[model samples]
Target chain A: MAVEDKLKIELGKQGVFVTTVNEIYNWGRKNSVWPLQFGLACCAIEMIATTMARYDLARFGAEVFRPSPRQADLMIISGTITKKMAPQVVRLYNQMAEPRYVIAMGACAISGGPFKQGYNVLKGIDRYIPVDVHIPGCPPRPEALIHAFMTLQAKIDAQPLTGTERPRHLDAAAMSEFPVPTQGAHDLEPPANRLVWPLPAPVASGENCG
Target chain B: MASSPYFSLAILFLAALGFGLAPLGLAVAWAKLVSPAKPNAIKNAIYECGLESKGDAWVQFRSAYYLYAIIFLIFDVEAVFLVPFAVAFTGLGISACVAMLVFVLLLAEGLAWAWAKGVLTWA
Candidate 1:
């Protein structure tokens, strides 16, 4: 028998069961994680496969895929995030309720995979939104995704419900929003640097406009 | 037991309110105590597939979609009307049966008309 089950049986024999409020709170959050039903690129197919009958993501209580960001607590970055899609991704992340988590689910999402060299591909989604876990693979298998979930669960288990340093979602001092990059003539401009119209003069020949 | 029907209703109302509000209150408190609240300019901005929204969300749609919805509503109401007649069939009179038959025929005719007009065909 599993150690927890054995412990539960022992507690039953003693006519008492003991656990902290934090344990119960973490248990509820960990079990019923609702991921946003969003996909970006090829890695999404693998992510979908994980939720199918054969894989059965529901067994971990995370199969409830919400269409709206407001109802989701997990954002599985399941594919490549291009420059054009970064703002929407960040927006969706911002919209998710407190105690939210982000799982970078593939090599493409983690570090842009083979597309890292592409001008339009963002190096990694972590540049904008805070990621809780990173699963590395060209497109990680369903099993790998499950392993990542286990890792995430372990991370959640370690968090203190009430402490000086709370989780990012609960921390009012932490970043709540990421700047949605604006589309410029040549590239997406970060909010810090808004693009000006009428291209500026190049200092030298063969200099890139951007 | 309370003799007044309103008394039971009042208890039920309180129970209903408790049922809805208790969990919501707990969640709000839990979030306030455990979660952090941080807001910034970029995070609060509207999402438009990562790009700035060029135009308003309102856009013209094909008129045929309205026709399709109207047809669906007509059939949906026809089904709703048939349910009561079906449940009380034995209690209903022969005239009532004939009236229902006429109703079904009228709906069938409407469906046939729509089919002939090619409104049923998805474009």
Candidate 2:
């Protein structure tokens, strides 16, 4: 077989499209959204609503909700941030791989929303992380949430190029004193707080794992 | 009539300034307290077109990027205003609601213009 044919055969076996870096990024952003499950407050309910059948977030490839920040790209911060939670939020942002984006998903996440005058809550998450999109509302409707995603997609489409610095690959020594907090947490979720709605328990379905 | 909107605006603007500055200040102070080591060799060099770049990766950003960013800001502000109106849809008088609808149309015009200019296109 010719060298080119052999190369083509190898690529076909891998089942990965050979494309430019920009095309790969564009493809990833348009599909395969894995969001971090950072359900902070009331807004988290609505974020989940976007995932449910009514709103059907699956259409946007965002149904795969990952708990670990390291594995997720979209960090949907769906509530207020307290001072105690700020460092942890920063840590999570740092932990996520490169090309990660943040979506501030409520009034509280935007500017403390209704809790603007509150003592402990952060006025906005943008102070800590560069928010790619802000979906404002005491609780935004599912349609509006979808709009925000579309708007973000458009923005991503407009700006195909990443900045000069490869933020993912920082210097090892720089990471040494990074003091990336791995241990203790300042705020604990109040035991009183629970899901406002009762979702069903999962059952093992006899379906093929596609 | 008695109280000045400008006064409240000035106060809010200062508050916004503080909100923007505080985190940046903290990050800088933290970085100083725990100074990270300087990059050496490949780390020091700038990134290129997905290659192990031979030269510095410090390419000056074009002004067009800023122009597009400013356009994005305009839409973002539109979203901010649209949210409140969307939330209070029922309470707002029909006349007020129509006025908001007109305002939204105006925002869509900006989007239309942006789209026409191919500013939204990646290519």
Candidate 3:
């Protein structure tokens, strides 16, 4: 049980602060969510705007955009992921230190935006890596990006430090690496990762591509 | 030992050592008790730019570059010494002026030698 459940708010008025270790841990984690400085397409422009003085992403404690995946806590997929770029993206995601989160920030990143019908564009990044939050927009505005950031922070705050539902980094049994797809003669080999993106059941007609 | 002059210094030394090590110890303990290690080949790879690294980092450079280094030092040292000499020129004595002249002459001699040896030529 949370320490807040047992402590009365009246005690807080007396200047005593009561919190569990988990709460403190989550507080620190949520506040210092440094995003990876990776951008793909037009949505990246909005992501940049979110960090500038006008939108002021620093107030939310996430203005530090890490150039390396090793130091980053969040990956904002802010554009279209072409077939050629998907492998490198997944590889970079795998290299990030655990307790990492991904925010698919636009229609392109979430579902390839208007490029969904394009042969070269990947339908969604979630087909390869697990996405923590999905912000839907052709190219989401800076405000929408901030909303997704808060949603990710709330998600991080809710994560239990210990339990079956604990995050992948804390759990020994969780997958450490998602397979990177390579380009083939016609298309990307094994188009999507079955582990993260399960194929739908076959239709009554015998036409299906796995 | 407590009454010794160095007793406070010894305490400070140990405190400094503890200050540096305590956080490291706490981090190790946190890793052991809270977060599990998950190492993989890609994560351990040398390059962090999302692409596989190709070719060895070690490559040979031409020994001919040493001539350029010597020639560069001539102008480099002259510029460094000339700035201070110019700033302090008005107040300097004859001896100081002579000393500065000698320094400039030495650098000029080196530059002359490099020019004679054709070191300034790009070829």
Candidate 4:
């Protein structure tokens, strides 16, 4: 046997396949989550709920929430981006080191919803930031937020970058348009930045509501 | 029970005060070391979701909306006080209940005044 083949055979006999390591690492990465500490509006409340006992966002591995942008890999934009605050949102995104993913977390962030007409509101988060996944709802239920995070993981692992597969996020129109409520904190950073994001996963299923 | 209220309230208030102080106070303490000497273009610029900012964000907001918000806050603060009274209904059964009712009535009277003045109307 040739050197490469012989090495493969020996390794296989020892139960160590080089190719398998890639799969294992990918699996681990796809499950573990480190979210950037940021929230723009009321949608952030639902984002926090996902991490609480009922939704338990930790099951899929995203409970760890980092306040400093440098450490976080996931950016869940959870609220409306008004004209005044849009620049700050972008600033926070740029501060985060890459291999990063953005989860647009509300109807307002996804399509500007009712705020699109207002001169101050940005039309969509995608207009400024690169969004990896879109979760639709005025403020989506916590379960949906978890679902969207899973969807992001699946897309990230599917090898879409090499042109082997078309990532689902590439299709923008399929994403939901977010509508803004008249009453909400304008230009306020949501209080959900302080959740126990990286918690121990208790169970796999969320029987409690979404 | 008499002392428990004072004790529990002390603990609760102290805990709240501690929570409020810890992060903000800690941040200010360490900020002198971590903070850069001078503000840069990036530092002054506002945050977009992930994109660069184009224009200034410090534009004017309407004064009328601010007035309405102030009025809303007055009622909001009064409502916040009622929650603690409601939760401890067993403790403050007769006297506290009557006192809260009177307080709420006064707050309602203010709301009525605002309503009559068109300050409460959104349209």
Candidate 5:
């Protein structure tokens, strides 16, 4: 629960501030999410527009698009993920520091979009790396990207500092490295990280379930 | 001692030091107490651009470029100082003229060293 829940507005109206360590930590983290600078295809144009003055992503405190994954806190997979580019994308996500977030920002990034039929495209980025938010659009408007940012902020805000459900960074047992898929003779070997994307359960022998 | 001017200055100095260092200390404490470090082979890799680094970062450059740089500096300084000296020749005293001459001579010595070493010749 937020510190505001305990103190309520009366104390805030009197000019006294109240907060917990978790509240401060979450507040600081949610505000300054620097996204990794990268784009794959058409959706990248809309992503760029979000950073520009028109949409002004700075109002939400995520104006900076860091060129290096190491410095980035969020990765907006803003375009189509081709089979060839999937490995490199996963590698960049792995390189990012803990408390990192990913927003699958476009139909293409969430799923292969129009390219789903194409042999060269990967179905979805979440199949490889765990995606925090999935935004659906052929190329979503700047407003949509901003909405995604707010959603990510909400997700960050809800995470408990010390608990079983606390974020991946706080949990020592949480896997730091999601195995980067390598090239094979036919396709990317071991297609997806099963930990993130679970395989479908087989049907019972006598079951007539559709 | 409290009434002394330096006492205030000492307090301000300590305040300034704390101002600079307090955030750094808090960040270190936060990392230790809150954030559990998660480092792996890919995360610890040298290059951050997603591409695997090719070849060694340490590579040797030819020393011939050093001689060229030294020769360039000698002439560049000579020209710069000589032009100013010529422009101010009427206002300059005899001692000033001697000082300018000495500066030029020092640069000339560097030129002579480069000439003797055959650094001027392009290999």
Candidate 6:
């Protein structure tokens, strides 16, 4: 007999059931994580492939790719975060309802991948929004995404429901919004600081615009 | 109470309200009690795909598209009206046939007018 069934049979005589509301709640949330359909760059194509019949993401209950941030439970940062696109990403992250999770889906999203050297690419999405999981690859295979989902599920399963300090999403007091980046004359600047290293002050204009 | 003519309707209304509100109320309560309401300035900011929004959201659009949509709606609704007529064609009187013919002809006239005006052209 299954352990749960055996336990249930024994507990039935005593009129008792074992399990906490938190565990049940976490299980439900982890299983039915609806990811926002937003995708950034090349990694987005791989992200789409994960949802195809061969590698159906539906098996893990995260197949629903919601178009609206209000409806999504997760945001998979699927590509490089350009300085121009950072604010919008943060905003979308902010717009998602509480209990929202983020999975940095590729090396680009994790640390700008090959584009890290590019002036316009943000080093990582984590600088702007809290990332729950990071899957590293130029464009991670669909299997990597599935593995990341498993890791995220493990993280969710470990969260305490009744602690003084709850999970970030569960602890209203701990949750803080990220500042939206603004466009500067030369590049995008985060509200608090320069998102990227500032280029040396315009070399006296007479120099070549190299 | 059960014999009253309005009893069933009253029960149905209450049932409908319960059905709609129960889940909504439960969800709201769960979110409030179980989910934390940590609001920070950054989390609340409007999202424009990560980049800061520029200028007003409003933009100008051609009014011609509205005309096209209105025309489409008129024709779409006309098709709905035709379904019953088509289904009852044998039972419908000659008068009904004449009325439907006039109705179709009137719509055709509108289509021809729109065509002549070049409203149907992509350009």
Please give the TM-score that candidate 5 achieves against the real structure: 0.74
Report the TM-score of chain B alone for all candidates.
0.53, 0.46, 0.69, 0.44, 0.74, 0.56
Winner of 4 and 5 under lDDT: 5
Reference contact recovery of candidate 2: 0.00
Q: Rank the candidates by lDDT, best first.
A: 3, 5, 6, 1, 4, 2
Q: Which CAPRI quality tier does the interface of model 3 achieve? A: medium
How well is each residue in A89-171 modelled by candidate 6, as lDDT tens digits?
A: 87888777778899999998987789876767777787667789999888899999999999999988778776775676655
Candidates' C-alpha lDDT: 0.77, 0.66, 0.87, 0.67, 0.86, 0.79
Cα lDDT tens digits, model 2, B12-95, are: 899999999999999999866643333333223243111234555577878788758868877898889989988988888989
| Candidate 3 chain B lDDT trough over 10 residues, lowest sum | B31-40
* lDDT of model 1, residue B79: 88
**Tens-digit lDDT track for model 3 on A1-210?**
465654747668888878888788899999999999999999999999999999999999999999999888799998999989999999999888888999999998987789987778888899889999999998888999999999999999988889998888777788998888888765666677778877662222223321
Q: What CAPRI class is candidate 6?
A: acceptable
> Clash number for every model?
5, 1, 0, 24, 0, 12
* Candidate with the larger TM-score of 2 and 4: 4
Ranking by DockQ: 5, 3, 6, 1, 4, 2
Model 4 misses residue A159 by how many Å? 2.7
Clashes of 2: 1
Query: Candidate 1 has what TM-score?
Result: 0.61
After superposition on all C-alphas, the RMSD of every candidate to the true structure, in Å, is: 10.5, 30.3, 6.1, 19.3, 6.5, 8.8
Model 6 chain A, poorest ten-residue lDDT window?
Answer: A201-210
TM-score of chain A of each: 0.82, 0.67, 0.92, 0.67, 0.91, 0.81
Q: What value does DockQ give for candidate 4?
A: 0.09
- Model 4 agreement with the true structure over A110-190: per-residue lDDT tens digits: 878767666456556675556789888998999889889989888666533323343322333331111212212443232
lDDT of 1 by residue, B1-123 (tens): 589879989999999999999999999999777555555554344652333457767888887677878788778989899999899998999999999999889889888888999887774
Q: What DockQ do the predictions score, one after another?
A: 0.25, 0.01, 0.53, 0.09, 0.56, 0.36
Candidate 5 accuracy as lDDT: 0.86
Error of 2 at B101 (Å): 97
Q: What is candidate 2's lDDT per residue for A64-159, written digit by digit as tens?
A: 888765557788888988756765676666656445678888799987888766556666777556778899788887787788887777666545
Specify the highest-TM-score model's number: 5
Per-model TM-score on C-alpha atoms: 0.61, 0.45, 0.73, 0.45, 0.74, 0.64
Q: Which ten residues in a row have the lowest lDDT in candidate 5 chain A?
A: A201-210
True contacts kept of each: 0.45, 0.00, 0.72, 0.23, 0.80, 0.68
